[model samples]
Target: ATPSRPASGSASPARTSAKPARTSAAPEPARIPGPGYDSSADAQKQIEAALRAAKADGRAVLLDFGANWCGNCKAADKVFAQPQTAGILGASYHLVKIDIGGNSSANSALLRKYSPSGGTYTMPVLVVVSSSGTVRTDTHVTGNPSLTADGINAFLRKWAS
Candidate 1:
């Protein structure tokens, strides 16, 4: 299900003055400081390395599919970096951040490989693959920039190797 924020209440019909109004329908996503995805990096190679490490360590592979410009992805990264969630992830998963570019075609094949038949993907999709290379979970992070520690922790615990 798509996560949605509660409406900020309807605009007063009579009171309208927006200096000509904004062009974009959606509000700009808020960004967080972090190392964004390396689009030029060989994602396939990275995944293979991570899979090897995961296999050796008896851990799962966390394929974080997202783009550098994705605010939600950055937010999820922040959550993962938190000590609590970080420990859970570090112990049980080999994280591979895959950059799905502007058109969502950069890693399209892998996305399709991991997705359900005819499944539509959103930004910041998290595909959890076991050490044996079997997909355990293909899901979206909590939501937008408001992704929380508890939520992330739950997800990690549920799928942790």
Candidate 2:
């Protein structure tokens, strides 16, 4: 006789097995530094250093512009630090965070160089630049909605290569 199906709401008997099912825990997300707007005159020096490193590594530069006080910026940082996203970023790009200050003028001149409007006017702006210092992804004019995990992953996938 065939075994009968369990009732709609009844609990099924637990089967005993010598070996337990193998399960692996998910990896912890990467933790990045909190945003702090840099106001030093040598900010450009720091950027140049990152660009050089990107060139040496044959990777692109991922410039993140925001202040520590911005909630959206913090959220974007967290999403970038997630394991899957971090791996892609770590392998393909050199990351740099530039604080644009509360008024968005802390690094206005430097920011204008990459922005289409030639202005440092947006918070949480992400710009991808090639090792040769050419802009790859310009988020200034059209704006990018990559603050969320899905959007960020898609953006990285599109530019990381």
Clashes of 2: 0
Candidate 2 stretches with Cα past 4 Å from truth are: 1-41, 102-106
**Model 1: per-residue Cα lDDT over 4-90, one tens digit each:** 322323243223445336553333321222456777777788889888877776788888888888888878888987878777777
The C-alpha lDDT values of all candidates are 0.72, 0.70
lDDT assessment of candidate 1: 0.72
Where does candidate 2 have its weakest 10-residue lDDT segment? 14-23
C-alpha lDDT of residue 119 in model 1? 53
Clashing residue pairs in candidate 1, if any?
none
Compare the candidates by lDDT and give the number of the best one. Answer: 1
* Candidate 1, residue 58: how far the Cα is off, in Å: 0.6
